[model samples]
Structure formats: structure tokens, C-alpha cells
Target: MGRSPCCEKAHTNKGAWTKEEDQRLVAYINAHGEGCWRSLPKAAGLLRCGKSCRLRWINYLRPDLKRGNFTEEEDALIIHLHALLGNKWSLIAGRLPGRTDNEIKNHWNTHIKRKLLSKGVDPITHRPIDATDCERSEEKKAPRCPDLNLELCMDLPIEMQQEPECSVVPSSTTFLLLDYCRTSLQMN
Candidate 1:
């Protein structure tokens, strides 16, 4: 089942918080302590939901919150964390003091992803883009079977296994190469 509601939605304020509301939330947290997010709004005398209060406190009102554009060091650190963590933004944010997961996620989407693409790096794989043009974002992906598990092994006949006396490749090797090219062409 879905989670029980956090609050009576009809009674809670939505959208942006006013400066007075912000002050009240900050004051209340200063007076008390953090956690008990579900009880924060009522205790703070704010007309917002607990989640709304918690997000506002964490994303905006926290005393140590970092503002303005991220520095070059921060940018590189974010990219490295994203490479290791994928879309686990909360985990990535935990390493960055005072930066929210939402902030990191937004920055990645708006800026870092584009930067990686410009440098010929695959943002998803965190590697150089293949020269085959197979991994570019603009290209449509090849169709795949859900249950497919492919394994390729090269096992040549004894006659073909030995290096050819002359420069010409054996028929079996040529045939195998042709099949590979045909399969790849079909996928594209």
C-alpha cells in the first residue's frame, strides 16, 4: 500500500514559503533541534506540511548552506561522484556538505551532462564515446530482447587456425567476419 499522508493537505500551505514563514521555521529549529520532520510544521506554527518545512530548512535555511555557482573543484567532485553513484543523488549529496540531492540532480541535468557530451564522454558510462557512433545520445538504440544473454567465442578449424602461408585469409575466417558485419549492420 501507498504511504499514509504526511498531513491534512487541505490545511497546509503550498508553493514558495514567505520570509516570515522562513524565519519562523529557522527560529523553531534553533530553539529545538532537527529530526521529527513529520511534526515540525505544527510545532513551528507554519501553515506548511512537514516535508515542505523539512525541505525548506535543508535546502535554504540551513546555516551552513552553500550558495552561488559551484567552484571548479566542486564541479569535478560532482562529476566523479555521479560517475560512481549513477542517479543516487542523495548518496552523492551526502559526500558534499550543505548541498542537497535536488540541487546536485538539477546541476547534473542542466550543466554536467552537457559538458561530458561535449568532451566526447558518455555520461552514463563515464567513458570515451565509441567511434562507431553507437553510444551517442542522439542515436536511436538498437532493439534488444529482454532475455538475451550473448557470448561470442572464436574457435577455428585446425586448417584455418594455422597462420596462412600467403597473405590471403581463409574462407572460414572471411565467412565469420562477413556474418559479424551483417549482424552489426542489421542492428543499426
Candidate 2:
């Protein structure tokens, strides 16, 4: 049999939340601070499941949310992050403060994925559209992507090439490298 429901579905309110529900949730959180989700509905005197309450509080009613359009920089960041992390939306969302995973995932599906496809890119692979996807000749091989088998020989002195003494490794550079390699893959 399928897993049982998380809560009593018949008892709790579902669908869109009302203004009073929002107010009550916010007030309860403000008065008591965040608590265990399972007990939250009962403690807050809400006729909603803890999951529903959590979603409402986090995705919509959170005061710290920077509601509005995602900036151009945000868009690029999301794309780059996706290329590196795939659909690990929570990790991507963590990098972008004020943006939720659900929001980013929806935006990607509805906007960025289509945009990349329009550019002849395979959004998931972040590479050019495969030759097989088109009615192209099998004899003519798909254009190969850039290979990084060769060592990165920066014209820097040996000292500069060495790892820094700092504890924190710079991840941005690594993320960009992955993005570059993935983007260079030929679609056709």
C-alpha cells in the first residue's frame, strides 16, 4: 500500500490560504518563534497541516523575502549554478539569498530552460543540441566540445600556481570552470 498521509487530510484546510490564516500564522511564529512542524499547527491553533503552514510561511509570507523580478545577475547565476549542480534547487537557492528553491525551479522550467533551448542548447546538459535530435547525416559526426586534458599552464610563476595558505578554497573559479566546459559542448 502507498504511504499514509502526513496528516488528517479531511480535517485541515487546503488550497489557497486566507488573509486571516496568514496573519494568524505570522503572529504565532512571531510570538513563539519557529517550532517543530508536526506540532506547529496544533500549537498555533491552525486548521492546516504543518507542511502547508511551513510552505506558506517560507515561500510566501516570510518578511525577509525580496519579492519581485529576478535580476539579470540572478538569472545568470541560476543558469551557471544549474550547469554545475543540475536540478539541486535547494543548493542553488542557498547561494541566492531571498530566492526559494521552488521559485527558481519554476522560473527555470518556464523561462531559462526554454531560453537555452531557443539558443540551440540542451538545457539539462547545458550543451548544444545533439546532432541526433536533428535530421543530420550520421557520417558527419557532431562537433566535439573543448577537451581539458591538457594541464592549465598559467604564465604565472610556480609560486602563483601553488595553492594559497588560506583555509577557504575559492569555489567560484571552480564553478565557472565547470560552466565553461559544459557550455562548450556542441549541440549539433
Candidate 3:
């Protein structure tokens, strides 16, 4: 069976919210604060669905919301956050006080994306647009740590193993031993 609807869609008002509707929403929120969105419309005497009321309050009517054009610092911050967080708009919005997730997402698509492209940066990867395929592939590959030995050995322990006459050690082992010695010397 299909899931039940959130509200009586036939009865609720649609299209652009009137000024009175906005005022009513604001007054109701001011009186009772937020939450109980499923019943908010009934409580507020609004003809909007609970979802609509919640969205209007959050995306437009919220007092703490920062409206107007984004600042240069905000642009830089959004880019940095997007690089780390990707398309997680809500998480990105959390880092930026007063900015809503919807607002940030819209700005990213409408402005920041074009800005990045104009500067030769790929908005998705946050890398140079002209970067070679080899360079891109290199970024995808795991970095090698020459001094770290991750090989699993099923043989006997070094102490239990019979030493060869030549006592030759693997290159990786030699590199690790050298790194340890260097670290020890540096610490001392």
C-alpha cells in the first residue's frame, strides 16, 4: 500500500505566500517557538501544509538567517568546506553560521561553480581543469610510505630464524632501519 500524505493537500493554500501568511507564520513561531511541524499549520491557523510552513520559516523567515550577497570570505569558506564535505549541503551549512543549506547549495550552483570554472578549477574535484589524466589518476592512487613495512610474513620470528652467513636484509627492511636510526638521531 502507498504511504499516507503529510496533510490535506486539497484544503491547503499553494503558490507564493501572502504577506499576511508570512506574518501569521512569524507570529505563531514567535509565540510557540519551533518544532511539532506536523501540527504547526493547524496550531498557527495557516492554510499551508506543515512541510510548507517549516520550509518557509527555515529558508526565508528565520531571524538568524543571513540574507544579501555572500562575502568574499564566505565564498572562500564555502569552497573549502565543499572540497572537504562534497554535496553534503546541510553539513556545509552547519560550518557557516546564519547560512541555510538551501541558500548555500543555490549559491554554489549559481555562483561559485562558475567562479571556479572561470579560474580554471574544477568545482567537483577542486583541482585544475587542465590537469592531465595521469595526474588525476595519481591522486586516486594511495601514497607510498617507503619507511613503513606492511608486508605480512608467516615465517619464524627474526630471533628464531637461522642467520645466513651473508646476513642480507631486504631493501624495505634496510630503508625502515635507516629511517628509525635517523629518527633516533634527530630525537637525541
Each model's lDDT comes to 0.79, 0.79, 0.83
Query: Candidates 1 and 3: which is better by lDDT?
Result: 3
Off by over 4 Å in 2: 1-6, 130-137, 140-188
TM-score against truth, every candidate: 0.68, 0.66, 0.69
- 33-80: candidate 1 lDDT, tens digit per residue: 897989888988988889888888888999998998888888899999
Best-performing candidate as measured by lDDT? 3
Model 3 regions lying over 4 Å from their true place: 1-3, 131-188
Order of candidates by lDDT, top first? 3, 2, 1
Instruction: Give residue 156's error in model 1 in angstroms.
Output: 24
Question: For model 3, how does the per-residue alpha-carbon lDDT over 56-123 read when each residue is reduced to its tens digit?
Answer: 99999999999899999999999999998899999999999999999999999999999999999889
Give the clash count for model 1.
0
Query: Better model by TM-score, 1 or 2?
Result: 1
Error of 2 at 91 (Å): 0.6
RMSD of each: 10.8, 14.9, 13.7
Model 2 reaches what TM-score against the true structure? 0.66
Question: Backbone collision count in every prediction?
Answer: 0, 2, 0
